[model samples]
Target chain A: MIDNLLFLAAPITVSIILAGILSYLGNHILTRGIIFVDIAVAQIAALGTMIGLLLGFAEESANVKMISYIFTIAVISIFALTKFKKQVISQEAIIGIIYCLALGTAMLLAERIPGGSNFISKTITGNLLWVTWKSVLSCLIMFILIGIIHVIFRRHFIKISDSKNGLPYSLWKTRAYELLFYITFSMVIVKAVPIGGVFFVFTLLIAPAAAATLFTDSWKKRLIWSWIIGITGAIAGMYLSFTMNISNAPAIVTLLGLIVFLFAFIKLATKRIVSHNLSKEKGS
Target chain B: MTGLEFMFAPLVASLLLIFITVYFGIHVIEREIIFIDIALAQIAALGSAVSLVIKNISGEAAGHDHDSRTLLAYLFCVGAAFLFTILKNKKIRIPLEAVIGIAYAVATTSAVIILDKGAGSDVHIHDMLTGSILWVTWPQIIRLSVVVVLTGGFHYIFRERFRKVTLSYHGVDTGLKNPKLWDFIFYMTFGIVIVEAVNIGGILTIFAFLIIPSSISALFAKRWTTRILIGFLVGGISTLLGLYLSWNMDIPCSPAIILFLGAGLLVAVGLRAINKLFSHQRQSR
Candidate 1:
């Protein structure tokens, strides 16, 4: 029983940490009008894994898998850079291209390589029940490190994110601000890749951040709310997955979606109720 | 024949198809209905799966062949596209996204089941995902070219009406109110996108060709005509480079092409940042 608990503990911790980091990065993405970049990046990561499998890399080679993800990030970053001029093209189109290209590449590669079908299938439709200890530990350490860094550099991060407001008069300057933004984004892609396997990462990252935005105007409050919602969704999803005997990633995504929906509904209801009360009071 | 002839044929054909897809994709992106392409592609894929099952059950040897199967798949895709459009108008009030998502999910699962049943080879399914541009036949090329020309012609004729309809939603009301025309244009675009998409590979190819190059071009070009021209250039370059890289390195073409586009975006961003920096430096100086 303890062994089973220990086994489950790693995945749960990783999921929560991932949820937190993704939520933070997702907010920045939304503000930049490049929200769909997450989806594109994640899908590209999956495609990379598919390519790894196609290239005769064993499923056990986590390092090779990581390499593929990096490749994906590189690809997505390049596409993002080139399409910087067109207002009409939009971020969503770039994301659409990423999705298509990744999936298509994975399919083509799978057809050629041995054991490619199995690799392709598993990568595309991930199974969370097979979470290993190594992945969990790496995720936990990365998450903690990121969390500490975020705490230390919170002000700087916020300033860069709101660069449109101009540089803040702080101990640090413009170069520092730019460095922090790039690092944070890179960390987000790296950490998110392993946890959600592309598709779920975007939802985990974006949904909580988006939900938090609806409730808070302050950056600090929004970040805190986003983290809280993300952790809550992760825990709930894991528990649900454990009880339901389903895949963990999908379960977490579904939970996050539900939470977003619920928040939206409650927000709508509260606004209506408050307005109704104000009108009644005025009438009296 | 010659290596150049063999190479240029597929490249030219793909370029024509990519052009058509990009134009329609731009409109789709502007409307914020990107998922419609994905959903329709999945529906078409589902139609292919159903066709495969029917052929298997009928024990039809000819129908099971590659050429025949592809033809059948195309027919089914066209049929599904029409059916989907009709269903959208039936007052069921189903959100287009939801319908497309559900259909895609169902189709994917069905494909899995059909493959498991040993009805069709896995290679066939893979073909549906990543198209082989090197193998595009002459007839297919002609078909795609005709579709591109027709779609472009239609867009040109209705350019004023389209601009009016799109802009009129902003409350200035461009007096070009014709609900039927809107429906006709959208359906035509959707139909052409779906058909051309299946011919290329599936929704992914259609989507990449449709949206990526144009979106990237938008970053550099200000004018609409210039944007389109640049987009076509980007698309054409990516296709050629992607094919070359894939052939040389023995990697998948689609991702390579996408990665190439991504590199372009990064370069653009870098240039913009440099421009800003230079302007700032000049002001200080």
Candidate 2:
């Protein structure tokens, strides 16, 4: 039993590290008002995996990973260029539509190709328990590299995320900043998506950051709290799933969901209590 | 009656969806929740997947049909709408799209997990996404027709109220009495329509059906009546051509039909571009 429990250590830890990385991306996503880009990028990466399978590449091969990153970065570049523009159809609508298109096209290709169905399930609901140390080691290396790059050019990302849409295209600085942000973010997504899948990645990315916003006005403090929430939620979810025979992905997702709701409730209740006390004092 | 028996049922089913989706699509577009159909549809499908896992674990054979699944789906979809309506109370708390994206993430992940636990989950999910509308039964068709007609009647009667609620109160401080109730009604009717739709069609085809027709029409049509007419016209043309091509090429029905709609949209865009150039030339002359 102890060994069985200990075996879950690596996967859980990797998920925590993943949470730390993606929570920052989640912050940018929330700030940008484009929350669904992760899903779209995740789907496009899955499409890359499908394309790899079509080309006879091994399921977890370097070639497959390379193709996935290439596809994701290209898609992200397109988004960086044009998606922020004002359209008769809104930006969120376009993101949502692109999401469906990616999903449909991926499903069609998976059905038509052999050995593709396996990739489909892996893409949608990844096997978090089955992650090997070799894969985890590679993830650690990639995560460290991406983290260093992000820290080095963190200010550029800040400038890009803080910039409002509808800026003139002639300002190459703004355009370059936006492209830099997307490229780095895509790297983060391509690394995390294979193990955790879209939902796991997205929940880690958004929920902690969203919950943190209620507590802190400072981005620095929020970043710290986001990591704390994500790490705690992931470990607790793993424990509960192990004890209760629940699936891990859903377990983490549901717990994070509950965490967000709990934070919101607390925020609401505190405001009410304060207002109620103030009114009582005035009446007296 | 002829060798085209398989195509006939799917054709009838697609026609019914085209009728209602063209109407609902406008509201979805106006509300800027273009993926609401897919979101609600997935929520409904998630409900059924949960029940299936429950039954399988308990080793009991409960009846699996439209009624049980639709009930669970409405419970979920409406609950979701309630949460979303509150989250989107327009006080600048959290953006509506963020809330929606979060809900969508959690719902879909829970669904995938449940489906993974239950046997034949892949088949179940595939059926939900790319439904075998080509092989729909008579009883299913009759049931769907009844639901759609009843829904159409309700929509026709309270059309103005829906228009008022969606258009007037879009992200504004409405402060009405129980606007959640109004949002509940919208999601409920939409749930009823799309649950019936998921019964015959799947998420992929139904999503395409809702958006593509109305979107193409939105490009050109001005009045509501003209838009709906153009929607029907395009839907009919696409269905005919898609089915014909599917029959000839032996591809899957729904994806082929989706491709046809996409093709149709591109053609519409191409024609509009040509028209724009010609108009510019005429103005110059």
lDDT leader: 2
Error of 1 at B252 (Å): 5.6
lDDT of each residue in B1-285, candidate 1, tens digit only: 475577776788768777776666556655445666655565556566667777778987644366555565556556545544543332322223333333343354345444453212242233455566667788877777777777778878877776555454333467777744564566556665565745664445656776676666655665667767877887788778877887777776666776676666567657766988999999999
User: For residues A79-183, what per-residue lDDT tens digits would candidate 1 score against the true structure?
Assistant: 534332223454455556656656656666666766665544443344345567777777667767877887888776666556543345442454455445544
What are the per-model C-alpha RMSD values against the true structure?
8.0, 3.8
Task: Name the lDDT of candidate 1.
Answer: 0.61
Off by over 4 Å in 2: A1-5, A56-61, A148-165, A168-176, A214-218, A265-284, B1-6, B49-66, B108-127, B168-178, B214-230, B267-285
Fnat, one value per model: 0.22, 0.33
**Complex DockQ per candidate:** 0.15, 0.37
TM-score for predicted model 2 compared with the true structure = 0.85
